[model samples]
Target: MGSLIFFTVSASAPMTVLAGGVVTTYAVTGSIGVPLSFPILGVALALFTVGYAAMTRYVENAGAFYAYIALGLSRAWGVAGSAVAIVAYNTIQIGLYGLFGWAFSGFAAAHWQADLPWWACALGVWAIVGLLGLFNVDLSAKVLGFFLIAEIIAVLLFDIGGFGHPAGGSVSTESLAPGSLFTSGVGGVFAFGIAAFVGFESAAVYSGEVKDPRRTVARATYVAVAITSVLYAVSAWALASASGKDGLAAGPADPFGMIGQWFGTGLSTAANVLFLTSVFAALLSFHMVVSRYTFAAGQEGVLPRFTAATWRRTGSPVAGSLLQSLAGVVTFAIFAMLGRDPLLELFTWLSYVAAVGVLVLMIGTSVSVLGYFARRDSVESVWQRIIAPGLAAIALIAITATVVVNADSILGAEKGSVLTYVLPGIVAAAVVIGLLWGYTIKLTRPSVYAGIGEGGARQAAALAGIEDLLAQDERIPA
Candidate 1:
């Protein structure tokens, strides 16, 4: 649970937001409500978790969104959801490679005066991540935990520095006001705030590797959410307080710049350093998530079984890890050959897809939660199994709609750009294909189809042609 919480928090990449997202949201919305939305979105996720955490108890595979969707919706939807999830996870993970390549190269160029290409930096970390991905998940978790603590400390220290010396010589409560979120660009605020919470849901993906998954998953998930929420809000609030009225307008253009100018060179340097590690942390977090999704999909016979096979000693998904690593190499090469701007093209497109994809996954999971318990009454109260998830589903649906309506604003694209329509269209198509794929499974393979969300146990049994044994009484009646 501790390690999972670390991975979850690292995935949030608090410093990255403080340095970029918070200021960007402030700049876009022209409203200080960006900080407030953290808590609002956190609450929505909390309600969503009420059902999500419960569903984890019964889901067979720790496929995270895929398992839940398969069990709650249908096996086909699970497969489709798995496709969308793999795309989404890869989308974000790939984008991070772009960001990582760009940031690291830029850093080396500026400080060390090394004229290296961004792709080189990208492939370098790709090697590190790919190598690490092949090992035990616990190792990754420990590294993430260290990065999480260091980054958090860096942000907190900066916050203290900001509070110590206000940007405009006086603190302002305008940002903390509730009405501020209802202002001009609240939808954009909702859109971006939700994006920051992307990898928090992925803790459940590690269920198969964790101890006492039911309790561990729940504990890590809730704590990850709570800590991510508070850290973002507090850090943003402090930064806003330091920036005051004037700096608020200038904040977005150069967030770290404002910090350096306000705080000092030393802390600013630290923030910059932490900024790189935070993004790296995010990269690894997403890498683990993407690989796990691929691993689970492979296990379900949706993909080649070899890809989902685990390393006996480390308990890591070796095949999926290698495949993801190979994909990263090919992608980085494509970007390099094309000579494209990593951040503007690769990161921009992929990040948008990932952010929206996670929202879509949650919407599916919310409904799946309701479906999971409704068909059976052997569980807890109606509130937990039914009403809570139902409310969550509705809330997520609304959130998804808000984001879609405000997509152009959020992506900073022209009102009806081809890019704008295409990104979302991809996910919608994936869902449709997934639904059909599932229905086909129902027709062709009854046994595997029947084991869709039973924790992969039934599916494994079915694949071994022992599904009948799974249902047979094992009692040695004497």
Candidate 2:
């Protein structure tokens, strides 16, 4: 069931919409080389997954970052990781809310002549998602699955049509050359690539709820990563080819707009619908991610206990879901009051912030993986422990650095560069707060500290057993 939720949410229509948005970003930044970047990033991320998957077998929890940190580092790190997860997923979710509202409002205004504000649509959708989240998890999964299938089919149709009618002469070899690869620079490609795999970690988070978590989680993680990579590679290639090398470089009015011209009105409408569905799906997926992180934190006593409460019958994290949904409502309300355009302003700004948070968390996870293996002195080969993690850390750091350097261009900032620093700064603050919290708990509650690695409920039980044994030993003293 957890795996189903992961797939439904991750592969939903919103992912496709996100894919289009990501592709557009790449095309603008990476140009004709955008297609190649996906594969390269995919391969590098898979390398990170090597140790990532290896670590999962040893630690299990619904909160992905929290669980990973607990196993490799400390409970403080786990708490901090959950904080980052909440910020990251919520940023993405809220950003998409802006995009969804803006897009749907435009759709309504143009198609139905309705003058309703974008926030009106955004709030309505938020209500629906919140209600759905309150119900059984399976229902959410089913809705996501339905949307995902339709979105995938529509995307495939666009791919076939684009490839069938190449915009330029047959596919060019120049797109594969080194010039194209470095045109956007390694930094640009890394940032864009990271977006594609942001949700891949959802697989690990579902371990507790999945049927055979050990196998299912690992398989799903790898499978989702592979499928997502291929889809990006193919769609990007087709999109670039459809626009032609020169045309692509020149930046057509709408790269995707050309699809409507080539495929005709029927297919164009289908593409738009798919894009909208993709946005919705992304919103749902991120919501699930944020709620689970909150639930995990509560379970571990890192957050308010109320968030840990689950619906007994459904075994769903009801309080956590409502909390996250409430956050979404607040965010929407703020943007609405500011009278900001959801698609152009809110979506662009918050999504970039979320991306930065995720990258920071990834860096932390990579370091923890290396540390865990180093301490264990496990017989696993050096590459898994040393090389892969080392390389991944370097790559992630480099990507983070590049984002910092090009923060203006990436964030679409005017003269002010302050917004560019906000993301990394936010992540750093979270980590520092986590470290402090961890120290406090360690000094005041040694028992909880000892059980941090074991996780919440299990850790408490283990501590009780230890106390019982000690009491018996004292009683029997002679």
Candidate 1: C-alpha RMSD after superposition: 3.9
Residue 190 of model 2 has an lDDT of 50
Model 1: runs farther than 4 Å from truth?
1-7, 23-32, 135-142, 177-187, 202-220, 243-266, 309-318, 329-341, 459-478
Prediction-by-prediction clash tally: 3, 4
Q: What tens digits encode model 2's per-residue C-alpha lDDT throughout 1-478?
A: 4454447235424334334454545433534566676677666666676667667666745447666776677767866777777887888888878878877776677568999798999998898878777773433566766667766676677677668777655755565566776643444455555655677776665566656755676566666666777877677667766667666656422433555777776766666666777777677767776777777666666666688778877877899889889889898899899987565457766766676778888787888889888788665578767788778878777767876566555455643477656755776787788778877777887655555545455434432455455334433221
Candidate 1 local Cα displacement, residue 21, angstroms: 3.7
What is the lDDT for 71 in model 1? Answer: 77
Please, what is the whole-model Cα lDDT of each candidate in the order they appear?
0.75, 0.67
Assess every candidate by TM-score.
0.86, 0.83
Clashing pairs in 2: 13-278, 14-278, 14-279, 14-282
Name the regions of candidate 2 deviating beyond 4 angstroms.
Answer: 1-20, 23-32, 136-146, 166-189, 205-220, 244-259, 311-315, 377-379, 414-416, 459-478
Candidate 1, TM-score vs. the true structure?
0.86
